[model samples]
Structures are given as C-alpha cells and as structure tokens.
Target: MDKKFAGKKLLVLGSNVGATDIVQYARDNGAYTIVADYYPADRSPAKRIADEQLLVSTADKDALEAFIRERHIDGILAGISEFNLLIAEELSARIGLPFYFTRKQWDMIEKKSDFRALCEKHGVPCPKTYVTGKEIPEDVMQQIRYPVMIKPVDASSSKGVFKCENEDDLRRYYPESLKESECGEIIVEQFVTGDEFTAHYTIANGKVTLASVDNRYPIAMQEGDPTTIPIARIYPCIYLDAYIEQVDAQMRALCAGIGLQNAILFVQGLYDEKTNTFNVFEAGLRSAGEAPYRFIKRVNGINAMHVLVDHALLGKTDFDSDKEDPYMKGKCCGIVSFVTKGGVVGSIEGLEEATAALPDVIEYECRYPVGSETPCGRTLRQLMIRFVMICDNREKMAEDIAYLNSHITILNDRGEDMVFKMKPERIWGIQ
Candidate 1:
C-alpha cells in the first residue's frame, strides 16, 4: 500500500473523544501520530493508539511549543476541544504552520458573545443575549422574561451553564458560570423551549456547505443540571428544507464575514416547531465531539477526518469540498449515546453482543469501563458508549435502537440500570 503521508508527523492536542479518530486517520494515511495530554494512558484512550505519547499538558504552552520544536512536528490538529483550539491556532501561527483560522478569526467565533454578534451582523438568528462578563442590570432584569440561559462565553461540554427559569435562577448561577470561564465572562440569553438541533457545515476554498443537520433528543435531566445534552441524534433534521430556505444563506454570510476557510463547524441550536424558527446558541469550530463525521462519511463518502488532516498538513486539500447532501441523500442515520447517573461503574454488559448482532451499527465505543468513576453522566463528559448507524428510515432505526438499548447496561454499585432512565423508544416512535 502506498503511504500518502509517510514522511509527515502530526501533533494532535487534547485527548478528546474525536482525537482518537484523528490519530487513527493520520496513522492509517502513513503519518506518525502524537497524542498530547496530561492524563494517564488509561484515562485518555487516544494516547494508547498514537505512534508516540507526549505526557505534556496542552495548556502548558511554553513546554508544549518546545516539544513541538524538538520533535519537528509537521502539523497540529485540535479537532473538538474549545480550549485546545486556541492553543492550536496560537502554536500554529508561532511555528509558521498552516491553520484554518487566524487569531482574529478564532476570536470571532470561539466566544459565545462574539459569535452571537457575528450572527446578528449577518442576519442569522441566534438567541437574544443580554450583557456579557457580568450579571444583567437590575433595571434590565425587571423588563426581561422568565426562562433564560446563563453560560460562560468560552466554555464547552456544557460546563458551567444553567437554565434559569427566573431572575433568582440567573442570579444564583451567574457567579458559577463566570467561574467556569478562563476569561471570567458570562452571557445571559433567552432560553428556547423546543427541540434542539445541530447543523453541520464544512468550508473549503472559501465556499461554505451545509453538510447535514440532526435533531438532538436530550436525556431527561436532573434538577440543577445545565441544559441536557442529547442522548441520541437523528439525521435529516425534519426541518432540513426549512433550514436551507431560511437560515443557510445567512450562515454562509456569517462565515464569509469572518473569513473562515477550509474547516468544519456545527451550529448548536433549538428549533421552535410552533414558530418554525431555528435559533443558535453554540458554534463549534471543528469536527463535533458527537462524531457526526462518521455518519457523513457512511452516508456520502466524504471523510471529515481526511478533510481536517489535509488542512493541518499545510493547506493541501485532496477531497472535493463543494459536494454536500444535507438531506442525507435519502438515508436515515442515528447516534445513540448511553448515559448513566453519577457513580463508579461497577459493571458493564452486552457490549460485545450488540456489536456482533447489529450490522447497521457502523461504530461504537465505551470510554468508561468497569470500575471507572463517572461524575454526573448528565453532561457529555460521562457518555458511556456511543453507537452510530445509518439505515433506510426512522422505523428501522427505532427497532435497532430498541434492541441495542435492551442489550447494553451500565450499573453502579447499587445494582440499578444506569442508562435506562430515558429510553430512545420515547422519540424514535417505538412502544
């Protein structure tokens, strides 16, 4: 087999969920991969898969940069972590490497306040946000409606975010939100009660394309939890055509205004079915941690890992960028993430059986093994195992998911079924 990247050495920062795939993708293409983080090899799975493991913290900029120089790293890829993107862009610029975004471009989209401003500038619909970096004014507070969201301007994985049902709720969560941010900033925005949706986009040679959109079905959240991240996401976002007609052009304008080129991003938002509106809350500037790229590749044959690797290896893009099928090309795809309650995983079951039985399950991974402690699996942090599949329709997806759900279980020391709290059958149209 010919090795396209035989001579190249790629540096992947942060052992995020997506980093494993990025490392594997690069290594498969004949490049040496380095996984950098401060975690033990057991904690960060990507470290075990890489050609080399650098036990240096990605946040230690000085030491990390020195290692890059010493290793003669050819490229650095920060696929999904919000904090790691800043580090990647900085180190890439300092070392005269090819980065998708400059400091200005990174600032424009990474921060919630700035991205909201950019959306408003280009006529894209985002939540109506109040002041950032501090609490809302007393006078403004009186005029505001109930049910708002307070979150840090620069944080990911839904950390330090709160869904405030009233003024008291906002006041209580404001300081906590601020504490989560490295920049000591917070944004209070209107909280929409509707189905959450995520629209994925890929930019190439200055042209933007809406690759796919999916509806995020949230796990039933416990009280005091931040807005629930999804337990499962089904593609062909029933509102796909509506999105193209209403918000796609404005989004393209927003990306063009910021001069973003050659990258993948997904806008996280809620769609009000009653009002027929799509409102955004977050914009991730790389492959989503949910691993939407897996579905995109399985459905349409465009590998996002390949696209990102091409960009990181210095401006060379070998794949076609203009092709996109946001409607999923007449196919149905689903990503089911099994989440458990807070505790040490005393046992795990049916993993091997499900993988063997379910032919449609393209990929699945469980990060928290037996005996591993998971702190509040409500957030994306504690996702036990994620299964991605593509099939013909929602009915088939429902059957497969129901079967898989019945098979897999993550129990704590209490001998309870941890992941059965919100069965996928609820939204997937199965009894």
Candidate 2:
C-alpha cells in the first residue's frame, strides 16, 4: 500500500460516512490522514480512523491554517456537504494545492436561482423559474403557474423546499422556506412532473466525461410531505441516450464556461419521456455520498476518488477513464436505500452476513447502529442503511434485493419491524 502519497498529509473536512471513506482511502494510499470537525473524536467516524484528529471547526480557517502549516498538510478534500466544499475550495487556494473549481466559478451557480440563470445563459434546459427579492410582486405572482416549488437558495437535502398548490400555499411556505436559508433568500420554480434522474460527470483539463446516469426516481412520502426523496439510485437512467443527445453537451458547455478543468459534478435532472425533453434543476461539486465510485470502478476500471486524490496531492491527475458508456457498459447497478418510520433503533441484525452472502454487493453501510436515537419527523435521517451493488440485470438485482430483505432485520424498542423496503418497481425503473 506504500504508494504515491507516502510522504503527503491530507486533511479532510467533516466526519460523516463520505468523509470516513475519504480518510480511509487517503491512508490506504500512504497519505497521512487528518479529520477536522468540532465533534469529539469518539463520536466522529472519520476522525476515529484518521492518523490525527483536529477539534478546530471547519469554519475557522485561520486556526486550521496554523495547524496545516504546523503539520505540513499537503492537500485538502471536502466531504459531501456543500458548505464544506466551499471551505475546501478556499483552503486549497490559500495552501496552493489543486482544487477543481475556483471560488468565482463556484459562486456563479451555488444557489438554485443562480443555477437556473446559468442554465439559461448556456442554453441548457431547466424548469421555468422566477427570481424574486424579499417579496413576490403582484405581477410575478400573477405570471407564476400553479403548483410551483419554493426552495431555499442555500439549503440542501430537500430542506426548506415546498410545493405550493396555490397562492395561499406559497404565502404559507415562503416564510418557512426563507427561515431555512442562511443567506435569507428563496427561489420559486414550476413543479415539473416527470421521471427524475441524476447525471455524474468527471472533468479533466476541460474535457468533461459523463461518468454515469442514475434514476433518482422521486417517491411519494407521507401525505403533505414537502420533500421529494428518491426511493433508490439505480444506474443507467431510462433516458440515458436521450440525455446524452439533448442535454449532455449543454451541461458540458456550462462546465467549460465556468472554467472548471478538473472536478466531479452531479446534476439533478427531470425527463419528460413523452416529449423526449430533459432539464436540470440542481447540482453538487463533490463526490456524492451515495458512493457511485463503487460501480464506476467495477464497470469502467476507473476510481474517481483516486483521481481526485491524485489531483489534490500531485497538482495534476491523468484520468485514465473509459467514458464511452455512462450506462455502466450494459451492467445494472444500484445504491439501495432502506428507511424506517422514525424511532430509536433497538437492534439491526444479519447485515454483515447478508452482504457477504448477497451476490454483486460491493459495499454496505449501516448508518445508524443499535441504540441510536433519530427524530420522529425526519426524512433522509430515517435512512437506516445503503447497499451498493452491480448485477447482470433487473432480474438478478431483484433476486439480490430479496435475499437482503429476508436476511436483514431492524427492530424498534417494541420489537416491531421498523425497516421499510422498496418494491421491485421502486428499486428498478419501470420503463
């Protein structure tokens, strides 16, 4: 394992599941790993595996730089959080390390409103939107169609998003949505109904490659739940070819226009199959926590994480990636999510044996172990586990999923079934 990063020190932000993977991956490649967050070392997963733990807050750049110089930190990587990504971008600039997007480029599309503007500027398709100030004008309100989505400009994870059925709903949810934003702004857009998907891209020296497209098919949660959460993320979206033909080039143009030379970006898209139209709504500039790198490695022999690490440490990376197939080269893949009605986790059983026994299961994570307390009204927080797999087809995937559901069991304090499993139709796309 002694490799290219042997003498380097890499500091990673946050201690969530994604940061844990970054820390271990860095250390495995011989880089000394440090995890920095305000959490106690015992409570932080990534810090537990790191060579050093920093209690300094990620926001305190001055304190972080002092330690960075003291430890001779050579590189920095942000976890899945967008706030941390901005911090990582700034730190890399100050430390003279390789970071993909400059602050100027990043700021142009950080907010939903601004991203929509970017799409319009580049001729990329996006939902119809209205950029408003503190108050929506009568003219704007009259022009807006019914059933619009109001979202905080700065929030993620579906927080502060509302689907307004009418003017009354907009007035009701706008202030609530505004409360969730750090910058005190919100954007309203038409709530387009269609199949939802996410496109993954890797960029190297201005060359953008469509790494993968997955069906982030939104599911119906409880009644009046404003959040549109994806049931699963299965590879090769139904409109993959149409997306490449219609939207991929414009997305690349948007990337190039922003001067992004080396980076990984994920775009949230909506497709109208009847009309063959595709549009983007949101995007993130870091490795998605779902860990697409698992199937990306299995399908294309490319490790996007490794490429990012190399760029961070060496100031340059050669992406020897096969970009020909964003469809996983005819392989079916997924990141299966298991959720539950909110409660305290009593015990989780047989996940280890199930994963080892299940065919084509590349990785699994029990995010919340036994005795963990989660909120009652939580959305994504209700996620109990995630499994990444690559199978031959939908039939094989169904078999693997059946095996997992039968083997793994999660219980609440009352000894009742707490886990919610997705049906085969939800796990794999119907089209």
The residue-by-residue lDDT of candidate 2 on 233-269, one tens digit each, is 8887767888988888999888877877678888887
Worst 10 residues of 2 by lDDT: 422-431
- Every model's TM-score: 0.87, 0.90
> Which candidate achieves the best lDDT against the true structure?
1
Model 1 alpha-carbon miss at residue 241, Å: 1.6
Estimate the lDDT of model 1.
0.80
Q: After superposition, how far is residue 297 of candidate 2 from its true place, in Å?
A: 1.6
Which digits, one per residue and each the tens of the lDDT, describe model 1 over residues 87-165? Answer: 9889999998888778777767778999999888888988897777655678877877878888899887577888888
What lDDT score belongs to each candidate, Candidate 1 first? 0.80, 0.79
- In model 2, which runs have C-alpha deviations exceeding 4 angstroms? 1-3, 24-30, 38-51, 221-228, 427-431
Q: Score candidate 2 by TM-score against the native.
A: 0.90
